[model samples]
Each structure stands twice: as C-alpha cells, then as structure tokens.
Target: MYAVYLFSITWAIVQSLPQGAPPSVCQTLMPFHGGGIRPQGGLSPYTIVPRRQGNHIVVTMTSALGIPFQGFLLQGRTPDRDIIGQFDSSSVNEGHPLDCGTPSDSITHNSPNDKNSIDVVWSPPRGYEGPVIFNATIAQEYETFWVGLESDPVHVTKRGANDPQFSFPLHNNGPTPPNYIPRQVKQNSAEFDPFYQGCSVTKLCFGSPANCVESKNCKAAVAVTVAGDKYDFELKAESSAVWVGVGLSEDDKMGDDSVVECVKRGNGIAAFMSYTNGNPNYGAPRLPNPQLGIQLLNSSIQDGAIYCRVRRDALTIVNGKAFDLIGKKYNLLIAAGSSLKQSSVGFHDLTYLASAQSQALADVSALAAKSKLLIRLHGCFMIAAWLGTASVGILLARYYRQTWMGRQILGKDVWFAWHRIFMLLTWALTIAAFVLIFVELKAWSGERNPHAILGTITTILCFIQPIGAYFRPHPGTAKRPIFNWLHWSIGNAAHILAIVTLFFAVKLTKAELPDFVDWILVAYVVLHVISHLILSLMNCIADRSSERRVTSFPMKDLGGPGRNSAYSDRSSDAPYSNFRRGLLAVYIVIILAIVIALIVITALAPIAESWTSFKSAVAPTNAN
Candidate 1:
C-alpha cells in the first residue's frame, strides 16, 4: 500500500511537468558514421562529448561518415521541465542532415562552416536569476545528457544607463587552425519560422533558409532556475490538421508522398511548409475544418512523410462560412510536390469521433449561451414592468392631492398617497422579478455552476428589501421617523439590488455586445435618468403650487367623512372625484399593460431560438 501510494504521488508530480502533458516530445540522435547527414568532407564518427553546466546540458557533435555531417542539434524542452531538455535531429528533411542555417549572431567557440554547430540558451526564471553558465562535452548517443543541478541563482536589477553584460568562451580541442567563423553575427532567418520573429515571448522561434523557400523550421526553449520554483509550460503545437483546398490537392497530389507535421519544442504552430512554388503561396492553404484544424501538439515527422497539421482550436460554423474562433482557427493542406496526381503516403482525412464527455461539454456550452439570452430578455422586461408601475403610481399620487374623494380618503396635505401607491407597485414588480430569477436559477443549475450562487443572493435580496418596506412608513405621520428611514434605506437598497441582478442577468447570458451597442446602452441609461429627474422636478413644482393653506383647524374638516365637503370648499371650487377616478383608471390600464407584456414576452421567447437555429442551418449554405 505504501509503495502504491508513493508511486501515485511520484506519478502525479511527473505528470504535472510539461513533458508529461499533451503533445509529447521525442528526441532522436543522428550518427555521423554513414548516416543520412553527410557534410561536404568525409569524416569518421568521432567520440560523443557531453557536459552539464548549471541547469543546461550540452553535447558535442562528431562524425565517422565519409563526409562530416552538417545538421542541427535539435533540443526539446517540455513546459513542465520533466524532461528538462533533449537533443535530436530534424524529424522532417531526414534525407539531409540538420545544420545551423547561416548564423546571424556570432557566439564564441562556434565553427562557421560546421553544419552541426548548434547551441541553445535559455533565460533563467523571473525571480531566481542565476549563473548562466552551461558545460559542454562529447559522448556516444546512448548516454544522453542529464541534468546536474536543476537550478542555480543569478543577480539582476535595473540600472539606469548601465547595460547588463556577461561573456563565456567555448573550449577548443586539438585544432591547429582557429575555428572558421563569420566576421560578424547575422540574424537567424527561416521562412515560415514561427519562433524567430518573437524569440523571447511564449511562442516558438523560427528562421528561414535563404535559398529554399520550401524549407521552414522553428526553435523554442524556456528559462529555468536551479530552485525549480518557476512555473513550467507545456510545449504546444498548433492544430495538427491542415485544410487543403480542392485546387491545391489536385495540383500538387503526388503518389505516396505526403507532407509531414513538425512541432518544435516551444513553438505553438505545428509544421513547416515550403512556399516557393509547391503551393501557390506558402503557409495554410485556407481549407475549412470545423471543430478541428491543423495543429501538431509536440509532434515530429520523418522524411518523405506527408500528413496534415490540424489545429485543435479550429471551430467551424455555418459549413465553413464562419470560423468560430475567428483569429486562431486554421489548418494546413500539404500535397506531394513530386507528383500532383497520386495521394501521399501520409494522407489522413480530417475527422475525429466525438467522445461522450466532449459531447456533454458542448451541450453545456450551448445551453449556457441560451440561458444568458433568456436572462437578458427577462431583465429587460422586468425593468419595463417596474418603470411602468412607478409611472402609474406617480400619476395616482398627483390625482389624490387635489381630488374631493382623495381628500375624504387621504386628508389634504397628505404626501403619502402617491408614495403609498408607488411602494405597492415597487413591491409587486420586485416580487415578479425575484420569481423570474428563481426560474433562471433552476434552469442554469441543471449541472450547477458558481453563477447559481450569485443568482440565489440576488433573489434573497430582492425579497428582503420589500419585506423591510412593508413594515416601514414615512416620518411626520402616525408612525415614527425610524420607519421613514427604514423605508428610504430599504427602497434604495432594493433599487441597487435590481441593478445588480440585471448585471448578473447579462453575465449569465454571456451576451457579447458590439462596442456600438455598449455605447448605446450607456447613452440610453444616461438619458433615462435625466428624463426621470426632469419629470420629478416638474411634479414637485406642481405639488408646491397646489399646497393649500391649513389656516382653519376645523374639527369637522379634519374628520374623514365630512372632510370631503370642507376640502372641496378649499379646492378652488374644482371637482376632484372625477379627476381622481380618471387617474385610477389610468393606473389600472398600466397594470393591465404589464400583464399583457409578460404574456407576450413569454410567448415570443421560444421563437427567438427557433429562428436562430433555422438561420444558422440555412445561412452557411447561402454564404458558401
């Protein structure tokens, strides 16, 4: 049991490393003796030299073949650093040995003409910068280079106008002639090289060959310190599948010849393509693959092997008319250059079976999108409902101020009538919105995500605000000032809750609005607030104009039943009951409108999805 537990822990640690992650890296060594890599002059495969300096391990290249092998020392580094680094030959272009493309920079101890003159350097981790020294020696292919000390420390700080500088010399063995090197270093170049342009960033490096447009290669490595505290990253290749255009495949199809997908250690894209003349233009042929495209996650290919490099991030929509991941989704189609008619040896149709888990995930994503839209619609309706009620309440309050019937029911100078009506409407709308939120919560929680928690909080707050208001009343009335405070505070709180809930609704909908739409919403909200303020000011001015003087403290006028006639005398001789009744009718009509809107919204909601699906199904063909 202990052993099993130990093994499990060990495996977990290893698995966490970049090498254990997806897009595995493989290291293959090319021998100098009678191997495919033949340099200009015949040379015997000499002893392999090896050494480890700090965190970096180095190996010296030797040859026994008739000609010295001029090939690149391909190094593979896993993101996790499980397998810190490995040296190998080019997976593609096996016919010729890998060699340094013309070097743009001159490093000391490098032989200019030697094809195998290659060394890799990496920056140390962010905080624990340490000695940048690396040891190098020669050895046979069987005994691979191993890590000595996994980490070391270095000192780095910003110094104004003080450039950081360091230097090291490569050891020279028995050569009487000084190593032939270019007088000045040249910038490394490779066509279709992904890493060279942005060498220091997360992506891999690429360099182009001057003479060959068809040949492209990339290199990548990550910095690590001795402490191993830095986070390691997985080396990923772009999609492994390529989308070949119908025309290109027909024009370049060669019998038993296929393009091979190649992934450099740290590069994001998968393969190198010759653009000179083989394909009309180099790079991806722009074929469409939905859900899957040309990407090689740390993959390699041998010479004369043809294969599609499909990208995993490819999500096609509308039958290739639209790319879901507009920027990243891509594929490469490679046909044999030799023969245009025959299929290549590595021809693979770009199709993958969807696993049950993946299908479930897809379904969930689709449903989430739907839920977001529903919430948005509900929130909009709720806003309209609440505002409509507020409008009616305000109108009702004004009618009660001067009406004869209102005077009998609510005494003159009664400021609470309109506010009372407003409260009732506010409570009603809040309750309805809360119920809608519950429904949304239930729908979103079929699989239960964190967002449901936010929904629950929103619902609880919705209910609490109105309940607090139900027991609270304004000051200067029969009730104490505490009630007024509670009423105002809770009312404001409820308003804030409503706004928050609407925001959550938008989040749930995941409805991405264009920039213009966002700007329009902002403008509309600002305008609405201004209009409400203007209307409120007008209502307040009208209220002040209608304020009646309470000079006579007549007991009969204060009494409820007789107060009507008494107030009527003071009402400028105007009839108020008919006006009050008309206002009441308007409130009723407003309430009815809200009910009708709810029904219409519910009925129309389902149609939106149906229309969307129908359009999605038909639009792609039309677009094509």
Candidate 2:
C-alpha cells in the first residue's frame, strides 16, 4: 500500500509538464506550477524572428545570449490579438500542434529538453491580407519562463482580384448573366463617363465638397446602386492613395461598421471587406469570410486615380452579425489614405468625409456632407490654449519676474498678476477643449492614437496645477523650496506635453488638419527654443555683470538719491533693460502670429479648399 501511494504521487508530478504545456495554457502562456512560482520579470532570454516569404512567413525562435530554453509555445497572431494561421507540419521541429480548440492555431514543444532553436512555417488563410505577427512563450525550465514575447510585424498584401491566388475563379466562370453590368470602367475615360453618369439621379453619389461628382473633380468618392437583392459599389480615389474604402455606419464613427476597401498593390487593385469594431489598434478588421458577401467586378489604376467595382449581397454577415442594406439607412463614410496601420486602415488624412445624416442606402439622391464644426472648434480651442495663453504664462513666470519686481497691480506683483491671469485662461480653455472632444466622440478614444492618451494626461496635469498653487506653502517656510520645485516641474511638464500632443493631433483623422500642420508645430518648437536660449543668455549676462561690478564705495547709498534711482527698477534702468523690452515685444508679436495662423488653419481645415476659393476669386479679376 505504501509503495503504490508513493508511485501515484510521483506520477502526478511527472504528468504536470513532462511532455509539454497543456492546452489550458494556450492563451495565458503560463506554466502550470502548483508551487505558486511565477514567471520571471523583464525581457525573456529567448527571441523570435519572423521573415515573410511570399504567401508564407517563417518564424524562428532561439535562445538569447546562448541561454538554451527547454520548452515553448508558439502561435501566429493578428492585430486583433487573435491566434490564426496554421503552422506547417513539414517544417516544424521538436514541436507539434497543441490543438488549442482552434486546430493548428498553436504549437508546443514535444518534450522538456534544452533546445537551441525551432523554426516553423505558417500560412495564413486566403483574404486575411493585413498583417501577421508571431507570438511565443519560452521556458528555461518549469519555473523560469517568459510569456507573451512577440515578433516584429509582417504585412501581407492581397493578390489582385483577377489573379489565380484570389478568392474568385481565375477565369470567367460562365457566360455573363443578363443582369451583369460592364466589368471594367477606365478612370477618367473619354469614351464614357460611367461612374458619374447617374450621379444624384439613378445612383447615390457620395464624396467631399458636396458637388465633386457633378463637377467631375473628386479625389475620392463612392457611388452606390441597389439592384433586386444586391448592391453595386463603385469606389474611386486619387492614385496617390494606396487604398480607398467606404463604410456603412449608423453614425459618423467607425465602430461596428462594415468597411469595404480597394487596396492598390503592385500594378493591380485588390478588394477587401473588414469589420472595424472601434478599437483601431486591436479590432478585427480582418474578420474574414469576405467571399461569401462580395463579388469583385473589376478594378483598375489609371489616369491618376484608382477605381474598383463590386457587387455585394444585400443581406450579409460580418463578425457574426447580420447587416442588411436593402432598405436600412446608414451614413456613408468615404475615406482614402496612403498607408495601412497593420490590420486597421491608416488615418484618412487625405479624405474623411461622412454623410450629414443616416439615410436610405438605396436613396438615389444627393447626400449632404457632415459639418466639421465641433472638430474645428476643438482644434481652435486647443491652439488658443497651449500655443497662445500657455506660452505667455510660461514666459512671464520664467523671465519677467525679475524685470517687473517693483511694479504691482491689484495688490499683486505685476509679473505674477499677469502670469496668474494667463495661466487661468489656459486652464479654462484646456478644460473647455477637453469637454468638446468628449462631446464629439462621446466615448474614450482607442489606444492606437497616442494623441488621445497624451492629451488627456496634459489636461489632467493642467487641472492639478491651480489646485496645487492654491494650497502652496508660504514663502521661506520649510517646504517652500520643495513646493517651488514641484510647481516648476509640473508646469514645465504640462507645457512640453501640450506641445507634443498638438504635434500628434495633426495625424488624427477627425482633426482634418493638413500635413503642413506638422511643419507649423516644428516651426513653433524651433522659435520657442531660440527665444528661450536668447533670454537665458541675456539673464546670464545681466547676473554676471551685476556680480562683477566692484562697489567703489559701499556707503554710496547714503551719499546720493541717484544711487537708488540707478538700480531701483530692473524694468527701467538695470543692465540692457531697453533691449530686453524690445525682445519681449518682438516675442509677443511672433508668438501671436504663429498661434493665430494655426487657429485659422484649424478653422478652415484641409487648407486646400480655402486656397481654391482664393484662386477662384482671383482668376475672374485676372480675366477682366
């Protein structure tokens, strides 16, 4: 009896992990340690490298710094954090599929043996064309392990719709059906203007500037036409854009929306349908099963534009939810951009116009563009806060405190008084701008945009500043120096963060600001730094000159009223006082100019429309 009990205990210990990590650890990637030992911290002693080879990716995991590991689990993952793509059986070594419910989705070591490296090949299913990453978990032994180590991204471009690798048949499957329309429509063709032929009459034409289809000058547009049980879609965008897409959304936002995109790769165009679930970073944009709903008619890249024609099922399922487009109303969101952010489309910096309101998808009439009033107001307020008021407040607190020592207004020192007012204005403007953005989005922004996170942090820091100042320690107290340092540190941090946040805001699609806005931010940084350097030099010169001056007579103050007059007011007669005043005036002028320029740019975004208006107005005068 005693021998059988001991054998059972030893067998339980061996069963824990002698073969490999169990299927239960597939997602968590943790070793089952009944002893409560946790995985080691910091970076793992293992490394994974993924190299893309045509339609496949070769993933290799090796020990770092000659630290051979004993066990590991591997999987191919998407930006959605989904475990996808089956590992090749012929290429795998010392590992086999764990069958983590999703067959072949994960691989694990066969035995607990110290190994140098394992190389495996993975093939993604057809139409999962976005990006893929290799995720790995490695263990030196049972206790010393690392979980969730990831490899660099590998982007996958979809094959052309006509290619043999595509979802549709390589050749024409059968004779053209009676209801079939023309397959290809050359862009800007002189033979026929097919896409815009029925604009606002037979088809629902949607694009920017509200009259682009009629005027025959649209950078990106979508024309939707409803047939018996299918919807024909024509998407057009400037060839400069790598991809263009149209989404059917109940609202202006991208959450839970069905997005159909035409991607330009090599010389041909490929079509895709994705589900964007609001998380621009981790959403399942490549939800797959696209062939069940969309049939590509033809696509082309010609005459400075890219175009694709498709027929979609009137009732289709995306991400397991049925979306019916026959009689339902949806706001058409048409966007085009030059790049893709992994699975998610890149910022539609080129075009991001939405229909004014939800309307029938079958409406064969004009669709008004959504007003960007709130977006413009948010941008303008942010500029007015950080660029205008914040700049004034920081400069005053740093440089003018010495110059305006003797001047007082409203029982407060002149410099401090003005600084307080400017800072308070900044605080108020920041809060208002913060509120406006929340009102616009109506929810927390996704993690993909660093601007949203940094902007929130900047606002929080700004809010805490006034509260800190109100409860600050009095002068010369034990904690006064500490309070001063903390105050200065927080103020500088908030100012720096605000400027950085503004730079990121240029990339936000909703802002609609032009790329030149980045140059504007750079110009401000350069000018701001130069001004600081100049003021610092001036202050150093003043301090050095004052210290080096040898007092010929220490009692001169008793001898003359002129002694007090010469040095009494730094604002009036000390050192290069007039030169400092001139610098301050110049600084204010340039600062306000840049701030106002940015505000104007935000007010009339895209900047191109305003330029077109200016040119149109001038052309008539020139003709006269």
Candidate 3:
C-alpha cells in the first residue's frame, strides 16, 4: 500500500510539469515558426511556386534552436503594398480560438499551449498586390504574438526553367547590387536585448523595482527578432538572455550548439551576425582583421528578457569542402540535448570565393603537411646522429686493440719502438674525432653545448699521456715526475669527460636497450674491458722478467774501479723482489682502473634502471 502511494505521487508530479520544460538542452519551437526580412519595407525579387497545391504552399522547417518554440506564420500581401492574405495556426493565442475565417478548424489547439505543431491555410483578401512575407514568432505570451507578413500589391513572376526568378539562391531573393543593401543597425552593442532590440525601459518590465532581482536562482533572459523575406523568427529566452547582433545566425537563426548550450549553461555569448561600424559580417581567417560573424549563445533565461552571454569561438566551416561533421555535430547534439537543430545553423556562403581561388587551398594544405614531417625528422636525426658518433669512437678503439695496433705498441721490449708511432696516431685521430663531436654538438645545442665542450676538451687532454712520453725531458731527465703528473691529470680528465658525455648523450637520446645496436654496444664494451685486463697482465709479467735479468747481473757491482770483476761472474738467474713488486703494483693499478671504468659506464648508461635486477655472486668458503 505504501509503494503504490509513492508511485501515484511520482506520476502526479510528472503530469503536472510543463510539456516542453524539463531541463532539455534544446527543443523545437512550434507555435511561432515563421520569419520575415528586415527594413519592414522594400521588395526583393522573389516568387513562390507551390508544388504541393495551388494557392497553398507548404514548407518544412528544421530548427537548430536550443528550445521548442511556438508555431509558425505564413503571410502574403498584394503588389500595391496592401495586406491580402495571412495564415495563423490554431494555437496562435496559446490555446485560444482564432478570429473569424482563419484556418481554425485545421489544428486542434490544447489549453495551456497544447499541440506542439499546427497546419494552417489562408485565403487572400481582394485587391492585394506585392511580394509576400513569411516568418516565425515566439508565443511565450498570447499578447506579444503580434508580427507582420507583407505589405503590397503582391508582385509575381511567371515561373520558368533557367529564368531569373527560378535562379534565385535557395534561401535568398535575387542578389542586390553591391552598396544597395541598407545598413540600419550600424553600431554594435553587447548590452542590447536580442529578441526585443527596439523595446525601451517603458515597454518592457524586467523585474521588481525594489531589489531588481528576478529571483534567487533566476538568470537574465533575452529576446530575438529576426526579419527576412520568407523567413522570420522571434525567439525568446525560455531560460536565459539572448544575444542579438547582425551576423549570420542573427540574420538567419543558424547557431552552433556549443555556443547555445555553453551560454544556456550560464556564460556570456558574443553575437556576430550582421554588418556593424568597423565590423563587417565576413572576413578571412588567420589574418589580422576584425572577425565578421556573430558568436553569442543564450546563457541565462529570466523574466521577460533572455540574457545573451558571449561565446569566444567564432562558428566557422569550410566552403566548397565537405567536412565530416559527424563527430562534431554529434558532440554538439549531445551538448545541446537536441537533434535536427543543426540544419538551421547558418553556414558561410563562400561558393564564389572558393571557386575563384581553389588552387590556393591545395598549396596551403600541402605546406602544413610538409611542416609536420620536417619536425618529426628533426627529432629522429638528433638522437641517431649523437649515438652514431659515440659508436665510431667505441668501434675504432675496439678494432685497433683487437688487431695489429695493440700488438705493435705493446710487443716485445725494444727501445720504445712502436709505442711512439701508435701513440702519435691515436693522438691525431682523437683530435680530429673530438673536433667533429664538438662542431656537431654546437649546432645541435646552440649556445648551451656544455656536454659537447666538456667531452671534446677531455678527449684532447687524454692524448697528453702519449705526448708526455714523447717529450720526457730527452730521456733520463729530472722532469720525469712532472711529465707523469701531466699524463695522469690528462688521462683522468679524459676518462671523466667520456663518462659524463655518455650520460648526457643517453638523456638527450632517450636511449633504451630495445634495439640491436644497443646490445652490440654492450658486447663491445665487455670485450674491450676483458682485452685491456689480459694485455695489462701480460705487460706486467714481461716487465718483471726484464727487471730480473738486469738486477741479477748487478752491473754496478761487477764493474768496480780497482778490482777487475768480469761480467760473467755476475748471477743472471736470481729474481729481484723490488722489480717484481713494482711491476705487480702497476698491473694492479691498471686492473683496478679498468674495473672502475666498467662500473662507471654501466651506472651511467641507459640500462642503469635495470641495476636493481642484476645479481652478484659471492664465493662460498668450504668448511672441513
């Protein structure tokens, strides 16, 4: 019994609400569905030939309006500028009966504005002539439904194929010569009410005079009055204010849903429909010029006036180019909560301009495509170039050591034979290589090429190791210690710079081990380290052997001044502790440096992120 009572109450509330007022984003206007041309006079060449029936013309209208409107009106007058015939729907008075002889029987009007649509027929009065007038008007109140159709001894042109009358633009009269169209509303004003622009403070009441607040939650409302030949509409804000201007949508009620709903949801809208002082109705895009279009949306509806809020976006579309408006219009429909409203949204008529300069569009579009491709290529080249350079040095070092160069420089001890040659060659190559890296990085990084500068400087200083040996105070000189220090400093700087450069290179390149090249690089580094360690051990052993031979002979002791000690008396087989220890120390230092180099490289490389996953094995001691 309780559930049944609750359901009954819910149904009562639903039934009590207005038919077309349920917070919809958009709705069709039915009562005042006709429109008229402005200036309220002057005739344009136009003729309407009824295909459905003689003396009766029927036209279907699709509104892009955000809300449902009142019914439409169809009017015609004589050529002598006298009213001849007029048709009104049954609900012109918002559920009231029409006056005598107006097609009252055709439509079944409902009380409180029932009947969302209506059909009406008219009979022309005698002695009427002039161009016919037609329009739509708002029926928010029966008292404000006053609108005009036409005034004249109605003019008519005989319909013919290819005739000037038949050639009239789909929704326009014969084109008026330039400079002939009158400009009435010259100054653009954002404050003007859209629906009733001509209304003064005395004519309309906004709200109570006391606080001037419509209500706690109420918003401003705007009214729009558009007059055009064969099309006229008087739209009012059922919820918010209306934006009135002399732009396309203003002249011909065609507005985008984004603008409408964004405003209806409570925002300011800008109107850019018709011509105004220093502001035309049409202009080029991406240029420094005044925007020539109306961009206003109905923001808030309150009292009698519909307040219009300005929209920042100018509603634009391509002419002579069909865009896939499916997604765009779908989004608009969803936002506005209405379908079939997009048709009435006005489009720019650029058929003439497009036809004249069709080729320019193609060029502009091609340029844009090419520009995007260039940007993509530049990014790709930057990484590939740097990595390629570093790879050259690694590859060269590996090749030289693995082949004859390493053997020649470190072969059997002679008098510092190939060491000098190998050192010179390596120094020359390094200079040239570093210079190349520096120049390229300068270009890539411009003024802030710190990585390039540091790497290049370090590489140059690294060659000092060989240079120090070449100029070692002309052999057995006192400056030998000084040369060692110079060599040590240069080598350290080179190693540190190389490590730093590799790190920055990794960052700049966003390197990863996903590619085959990265795997190859890792393999090369491992091989280089292993070869360096083995060769260093061999050199240490050879040095110890030579030192033992020299020490065992004891040349200073054998060749004394007084006693004649023969060279043959000297012991040649005994090992020398000092010589062995000195050679072992050098070997250990070399081994340690190689290990350190490997560690630093691995830590700085792009694969450093995987360090935590790597396992280190520890040798277990066997217990008895």
Which candidate has the highest TM-score of all? 2
Tens digit of lDDT per residue, candidate 3, span 1-624? 423533543343334323322111011112211111111112212222222234443422222232333432333333332224434443144332233233321221234342333334443343432244333222322212222212122233434332212111234333221112211344322232233333221112121111111121112222122111111112232332222221222111122211222222233322332211112222212212223223332222434233333322222342322222111211110011111112222221100000111111101111100011222222233222223222333222222221221233345322134334434544555565555543433333322236556655655575556666566653234554465455545654565465455445433322222233334435445554664565445434543765532222111222234322322333332233344335434544543454344334433332332332131112122221
lDDT of 1 by residue, 1-624 (tens): 423533543453333321211111112222221101111111123323334444433434343342233222222222222222222223122212222222211011212133343333332322322233222212121111111111121233222333332233454342212111112233333332322222222121111111011222211111100101111111211233232121112111221111222322232223432121232222222123312333332222222222222223223333224333223211212222211211221222221101111111111111101123344455555555444554444444433444443344355344345556555666666567556655654433321134455545544554575566566543334454455444445544545444444344332212222223333334434544554454445444543555743222222223343333434554442333454456456545755555454434343433343344456568779999
The order by descending TM-score is 2, 1, 3
**Model 3 lDDT, full chain set:** 0.30
Candidate 2 residue lDDT tens string, 42-85: 55566777765555677878855777887888887778777787
Error at 382, model 2, angstroms: 1.6
TM-score for candidate 2, residues paired by index: 0.62
The 10-residue segment of model 1 with minimum total lDDT is: 360-369
Provide the lowest-lDDT 10-residue window in model 3. 349-358
* Estimated TM-score for each candidate: 0.31, 0.62, 0.26
Give the poorly placed runs of model 3, Cα more than 4 Å off.
Answer: 1-418, 437-450, 463-470, 492-496, 509-520, 538-624
State the weakest 10-residue window (summed lDDT) of model 2.
173-182
Q: For candidate 1, report its TM-score.
A: 0.31
